[model samples]
Target: MPSKPLTTYVTHQPMTAVQVLEKAAEIVAERYFHGDVFCSAKATKDFLTFKMGGYEREVFAVMLLDSQHSMIEFRELFFGSIDAASVYPREVVKVGLEVNAAAIILAHNHPSGVPEPSQSDKRITSQLKDALALVDIRVLDHIVVGETCVSFAERGLI
Candidate 1:
């Protein structure tokens, strides 16, 4: 969140080193994206899909944004097995606070390439929306990215 130089790993845990590097690299690269307003839902979807499209496993991520919907940081927060990712509201709120994010966009990949929100996805989106709202951080959308992206917002599920 803070504008510090990013290095790959800080913990001595048993996680995939390759994944760690990939996530860190994404964060670093995001710092240089074009300074365009991301309020357009269509553009937001395209951007999120671009970010998560190629992942083999499910990756839950967020794009931290300022009140004007400009980018602050992009994070790949949770990695999971082929079908699922365990999303934690607390950690998301922590990062939101860390970046001083005024709003957030949630996205995840479905390796099955279906691009549909499962029931679990809907449930978690509701939970996260409530949790973040408590901190006055609006949720712009919850996008499921696979072969394509499905927006809970467009469908009014958020």
Candidate 2:
């Protein structure tokens, strides 16, 4: 007698709205955060917005990239209150060095619906750019995610 071919079965479990959102975010990150897939400013903005847009407080993060500009990791380095987060250049540089990142895209979220880069934001970006420069890591852009996303590179702030 001939044996029947076996078939694999799969099941789909129902997920809540938050769980679905989280799963979608995970899929987006997996697709965009690897290889040179983050090739456009719009793509980067979308990824950063998804990652930081829902926060109630300030969150400072970096997208560590390899020499080929592929993402190495997305790290949230600092957390703070509604308006401010203490970003340390030394720590940022350290993380870049530790991961051997050749470039970085900085990101932070404003709790208010405003995406404008404040004077403080500008100053920190400048500081972080200068600090990362010493280690030969490029500062690609500084993105402020709020109601919309703002790119420092587009504004020529980087």
Candidate 1 to native Cα RMSD, angstroms: 10.2
Which residue runs does candidate 2 get wrong by more than 4 Å? Answer: 1-21
TM-score of 2: 0.85
Candidates' C-alpha lDDT: 0.84, 0.90
lDDT of 1: 0.84
- Of candidate 1, the 10-residue stretch with the lowest lDDT total is 28-37
Clashes of 1: 0
Model number with the top TM-score: 2
What are the root-mean-square deviations of the candidates from the true structure over C-alphas? 10.2, 5.1
Q: Write the per-residue lDDT of candidate 1 for residues 8-115, one digit (tens) a residue.
A: 876777757566545655654455344554646666666666567768899999989888778888899999999999999999999999999999999999999999
Q: Which candidate's lDDT is highest?
A: 2
